[model samples]
Target: MRIGSAASLDELFDLVLEAAHEAVGYESASLMTVDPAGDALTVRASRPGRLVGTRVPVGPSISWQTLERREPIIIEGPADKALGTTYTKDVPFSICLPMMVAAKTHGVLNVNRTAHPGSDVPLFLRILADQAAFAIERMELYGDLQHFTGQLLSQDEEHRRRLARDLHDGLAPILVSAHAQLQSAGVENEQVDKATALLRRAIRETREILGTVRPATLDDLGLVAAISAAAREMATESGWTLEEALDDPGPLSREAESTLYRVAVEALNNVKKHAAAHEVRLALLKNEDTLEIDVADDGHGFETEQWGEAGVRPGHFGLLGMRERVAFLGGLCKVQSKPGEGTTVRIVVPRDRLR
Candidate 1:
């Protein structure tokens, strides 16, 4: 009745079975939810006791007709000896109702009466069906939310992979070439020391950009080597000293490499952009089956939840993107940050996925 306010699944099942029994006065009343894999209705709850997960084959149950028509089905007296011949024989009147949500039927609510269920039985069956339909809608809505979150997380990871590739192949080379030209010009204009100083500054800028642009070294090397290289570069450019401890060897996958690389890049960038802290720590540790890449910044931190979807910011919009990338690889990306305290980003991908 008030099942929508149910606190537990068992509580909700109790409501459905109790209503089915009181209304139709059937010898037994049972609830069968749709089973996609079994391609039939599998009993979930019953009044006279259930054969838990009992399946009524898809082909011949009168439930199929109710589901197909999205309406109540009544087999008065005898059902013309049609589908469910054996089941119909045991009961004088059979009623089936399709449980629906948003006009889509998910399963059927079946009621059978050993004694003829007069017209009132049909109306009562409708009430039980309504309650069940609401419950199914709520469940389906919850399922939709889970599916959506998964998809969003997946899409984010794909975006990061593309961003990482762009930073490496697209921007890194351009900046490197610019640095070479600046160095060459500095050599040629030594007579003008001020001009030479400007060239040197430009070269330093290119190096800083390279720190973020370089290809994920983990993919080329392994996790340890890649993190080590990234640590050196981030230290050199941002002046935010970083300490790193890497464990897993060259066996990690290309996707894992990309994931760790993105995590470091985002962590270092946060240090330079907002952390204001003087140092950071990067660790790639393995605890049994889970591989965790941890990036901690000593700088001032902010509320992780308030960062909005995928962490929003202009010019330096990478953290949210990094989380998305981690999710796609069947991994989790978590950021722990408190204002004026510190910030830590953890990217943990499944070991099997890496394998």
Candidate 2:
């Protein structure tokens, strides 16, 4: 709140990133500015060496809730991603923090992650966002603002989902048929073994597609079972060791269950992407009344303090999305990381908050 007016735009952007990075341990950080046209936001600054100078349209974004309502909108997760979910029309997983100075809507500030930022980051984001809004609003430039990293991220995700689906629907069957043909053929020598290996590879690709498309089995079975399958799949694919400890999970509210699954999905994605450790530990437990999950890795941890302001890594929406999703559920998410020590994400939901 005490950031001086004399501070340069570069310095203010630094403060924004520092606030966001310090709030949550994101390997990447960004603060986007809405454009004057009320149509797009550009990533003016992002982590060092990151390609974040990207911009996207906000004319059709749901985060426009800030512009429409003139306030902030907090989102929980992708539970609302059902094909026809209203309010989520063409936009998913974006939380908007409005910027208003002198009673004019100069622009908006957007912060996001490729993976889910924990619920822990929002409060800090909300605060630092206000500071950044003031700084950005104060920047003495003409068409001064970049708007929607939310849109870019959402679109990218939509593409990933679509690509994953295409891989499943467009190519998975062909691979399956090939596997069947190889099995029924009379080739029983080294050729058969090679065919068998090819079939295994194809099946693995299909599983990867399914994982990307939001694991179907997750919806059929409960979160615990689905996440266990994901962990095992990760281990099998990467040869990394995984340790799982889950108790008997009772029937959670549909929303609660969904939140758990999505958060776990983000956590596992992080483990796969950043956690270089060969061994991972996942634990889900009901501590009498609270629902808690801990995903930890003995990998090279990230330095929370080094991230710059303006924009996060071009594609890193994990932490930002997670934070928004958990906040919607009234749950709490925390991340602790240390270089070489490891990184751990703890998500805790109070029983009373379950819906």
Candidate 3:
């Protein structure tokens, strides 16, 4: 609590990191902040002789997993292969917790010890982390309010512009031509058939546009139904096999449902636009604690190190948007890819956010 009351974030982090080491009695500790583009986490502070100011891709580490899942993780005994290879430490225990506020994770707090921390240690650290997270969130919320609003407005406008352009250039002409054909000397059977086909095509296009804007099925049926509907269409268009394994997801707040739906749409769009795979699988699972959405594709992947870096291809705005949307709901989004392997985008939002 004392650390959280600092006047500035730098002061707060310095005190918080110190508390993680001294008060928590960890041999080593570090603090990292998520990058603005949401592709990387940069070490902001660490114990002596450890890497500071180092930026790494968000994966294969407990800290990243905590950030990706927005939950606290404690590992005992030998670490899993993914966790063992992440950082060069001979420690026997580690604790990672997400610094979250209002569903958004601002950063991660990581601590390591040579042996298991006592029962009280975990509770103490958890309480400390929560307090610290709340403080940082309060600071960030006040600091970034204007900037966040501006970003939201800008993205919304861009989305509106795209929709307007599609309607004006694509759908309007079809509808107008159909109307003209109907008004012309269309007493002949051939003219009538042509007019009917044009009108049908126009109606389909209109529905497609509306679906993209806001799927009617989402409100009428629910998220699973809406996702299945969109995925089926994508599969037919791309000639890729789409598999689904959706458990009973139950109900969610409108914002949560819409955000998840948008993320699924973006993931599938990426598969269609970039992945040359023949198969894709999407799964939605509801467990006791959280809801997870996974989109996996068997397509050629790209190097994670090179992602969002300079000289990369330009069309990653979809990914940026997906991350932002998920983060807004206090969720974590992770994209994993390898060169000849495939890519998987997983989003995990806590069930507490559900209505």
Candidate 4:
């Protein structure tokens, strides 16, 4: 009953196993959680604590059957005759209940007792398993919420840094030169002209900063044209060969356009900063219901294994932002690279999701 107040999955598992052993009198019990890949379930907590972290394939196991049916099952007689499995056959009575969250079976809770249990055992155990399922689902949603909040905070800090750099490098010098010219009492026509030119450069720099915040071209020319112009700009600035093949996917929602544009910008910036490549390629293609933006470079690649759990490199904060942006649009972002080879980043979103 107190399982609802558990703080983490580990704590919940421990509480559930203990409750089942003490209150339910199951004698032995275990809780297993499905892996993210959905291929296997690992024992998260067991009464004996010996089978913790033990993973078993889901193929043809009673746990798999329970998951498939999305219900609880009971077995009588010997373990081999009851469950048809060599593993854990010594236990005479067994019951397995699927842990469900919003119609999805996330895992299974298994209990074993010596004698044949009545119907009340399964019912009582199912109630406890439901509590555990709700706790796990809540924890998963809370974790996702925390991750997105962190992503937003990271983006806010990055934006501040970019603005600071823009002012220091571009506009500050122009203002200093203008101030110096004004301080001189004997200012000539040439001095006035020079000051005027510096003022114009300052205006241009400010406009560039605004553009960096949110490109006016994205709203004016649309996603495809905006991406093409950005690609050309990057190639000109870096002096790298640029290849582009953009298929007009028609008009997308403003959110989709912005997300795709930002992802492309991040990819191109990475190429400029990290990739010492002589050539780069960008392509936007629409196939059926999917729209894909692909960027590839000939630069020296990195080890793909360095990517963390979310498919973004640990120190590459920009890539993480790109992934978060794509995910918000209900899309997938993939980055692949291998040492001595090259690197490619792809962003794929569904057409319907864009709308």
Candidate 5:
């Protein structure tokens, strides 16, 4: 297997070791991962298997020197003096290759043999170590990206919650109180009546804004009820026949619930705005270990390829936003549409991740 094709760090390490063994036919080999502090190396994968998890400090050793110099070190004859008695003392020859890429050292790969393999073996081992290093670096960078995305989504949700709370607890109540006072005064003037009507309208609009920011039904009732309420409201406004088959997904983490709810609402909004169809269907179901949300509209759909083009097009931002939101939760969002045909937006998330 190519080191670059490795899906995980562990798999990469194993592949690197296997490649080294195949290149030189070493009697024993070990792959060690550098700790975060760069102060020690731990044997993550070894041909003998028993050496796995063994930790060695990065002192004045050949492995440490190789990592520091970012080069390969070859030791011929007995390595008892170079490598401590605890490691490869009786091996007649050995090579330590630094696994490094972009000036960052990831670990060291060591191969030991009972006799000298040949001068050319070190070159092959160096190339293998370089590939392994690049793969390891890529995996670490991807992990960092995932972590950053999670944090960004969490912060965005918190901001939305705060804004919704202020509108509900601060602005909405003031409008309600003003309207109540006007009604209680029983003013018998045209101006007073108009003022009361305006206040009532303001209060209603404020509540709508609050709901749009963050729906209380999601927190009070659950995801299913919130989605059902949203779909019904959209259908009523759009004069579309609404069909729902929502199965209560029990409970979910706040983040999971919010992500799914937002995606569903976005899909519905797209249908209301773009899909000129007379009917729409929304379904929520549990398929074994996965939860799925489907929204379909029999509207005048466009080419689905235009959804994720280079430049922004009509409805591209919303679709991209929905996809990103679901992706952050390790879920998938798919939109299918064609001219003269309807559009279907499907989202699937792992059940375990919901918790």
Candidate 6:
């Protein structure tokens, strides 16, 4: 049997309940998710749909026994009075299966019927419960991964901002002072002129580095302004006819603004380096509760099927990194391209999440 592709915790619960009903018939079925405190189980999904949100504390009940024993518990008599439900009380036969993965009980799957199920039903239910447990475990691990990645990205950006500030405030001023001293020395020697010229270049390059590291426009202005600045720079360098439809997204958290700006810059850089087109369209729009940024290029497109292989090429990891960054913000990054068509990179993030 296929297993383990449920997207969210709720969906996993519904799948487990549905699978229980299909694999072994049940008059009523419910999936209980273990609370974070591990002291109770909450009915997240049920076949009758009325038991949702019902909470059952860990007590001397069959469900609790199944969880503790890490096995299926078959009850042939009246429903446990601790359940405190007329629907459960009416059902004379029930089975509570522990959803265990790696010797850890995540939850319990309860199935009730008026008559006893076949002798092999427990085995099948146990298998189904195990699969559901594995899916839940995988989903939890993925959630943890996304949280860690978000933290790492935030820290990395903070480090870059700090380094940029040091260069702008600490190093750039020293270079400027050196240049001024050389100019005031009243020396027309070729060596002095060369030294002064190098100092000026260094100052100029330092400013450029500061801009690239963390653009001041991003913090002072906002995401739209920062993206427009980046887009114009890339357009000038690539000689692409740039069309922009930027809208102010109002105030956003520092992290959200930074993530959007970096993703936009990466998209533009990819176009400048790889796309041999003459036209590019950049858009920053706030639609409903979402903030969207789109970078489309009328370039010679390649098969998107090669996206994975392309990421391995030199200077192409940005494509994958862009997606990961957006995902970290609970957003989506979509790349649509076809040969002889064009390429469009769109990122949509929930506005509330930005806060």
Each prediction's RMSD over C-alphas, in Å, is 19.5, 24.2, 24.7, 23.4, 19.9, 20.6
lDDT of each: 0.67, 0.64, 0.75, 0.78, 0.80, 0.80
TM-score of each: 0.40, 0.41, 0.41, 0.44, 0.45, 0.44
Count of steric clashes across candidates, in order: 6, 35, 1, 0, 0, 0
Higher-ranked by lDDT: 3 or 6? 6
lDDT of 2 by residue, 1-355 (tens): 4454436766776666666655654545455566767578666666642646667566545445565576666554552453223453222344556656546664455554444645655666666666666566546531121112222234565565665676668766777777777777768898577757756565654553344344456567778898888888987886778999997677777767766787887888887888787888999988887888999988888765555542233224466556656777777778777899888989888877775
Among all candidates shown, the one with the greatest TM-score: 5
* Top-down lDDT ranking: 5, 6, 4, 3, 1, 2
The ten-residue window of minimal lDDT in model 6 covers 307-316
Taking all chains together, the TM-score of candidate 3 against the true structure is 0.41
Tell me the TM-score of model 1: 0.40
Give the alpha carbon lDDT tens digit for every residue of 1-355 in model 4: 8897888889999999887887668767889999999999999999878999999887878888789889887876544555556555567788999999768787999998886678777888888888889889868866774564444335764564565466547755665555555645466688466655545444444433333355567768888889889889989988989999999987787768877888898898888888887899999999899999999999988886766566654223467677877888889889888876779999999899887
TM-score, cand. 2: 0.41
Model 5 lDDT per residue over 1-355, tens place: 4887888888888988888877778888999989998789999999888999998896877788788878897887655574553343468888999988868899999998886758788888888888888788878966874554344346676676776676668877777787778888977899688767767665655544443455557888688988999999999999999998988787788878978898899899999999887999999998888999999999998787763563234212467667777888888988888998999999999898998
- What are the per-residue Cα lDDT tens digits for candidate 3 across 1-355? 5785788877887788888777768778888778889888887777763678888786777778887777778877566675554555678888878887668877888888976787877788877777787787767754664353344345664574465466657765666565555756447687476546646555444433433354446777789988888888998999999999998778787878878888898899898888888899999989788899999999997676674553223322467667777888788888889988999999998899866
> Which prediction has more favorable lDDT, 1 or 5?
5
Off by over 4 Å in 5: 80-88, 155-355
Off by over 4 Å in 6: 1-3, 79-88, 156-355
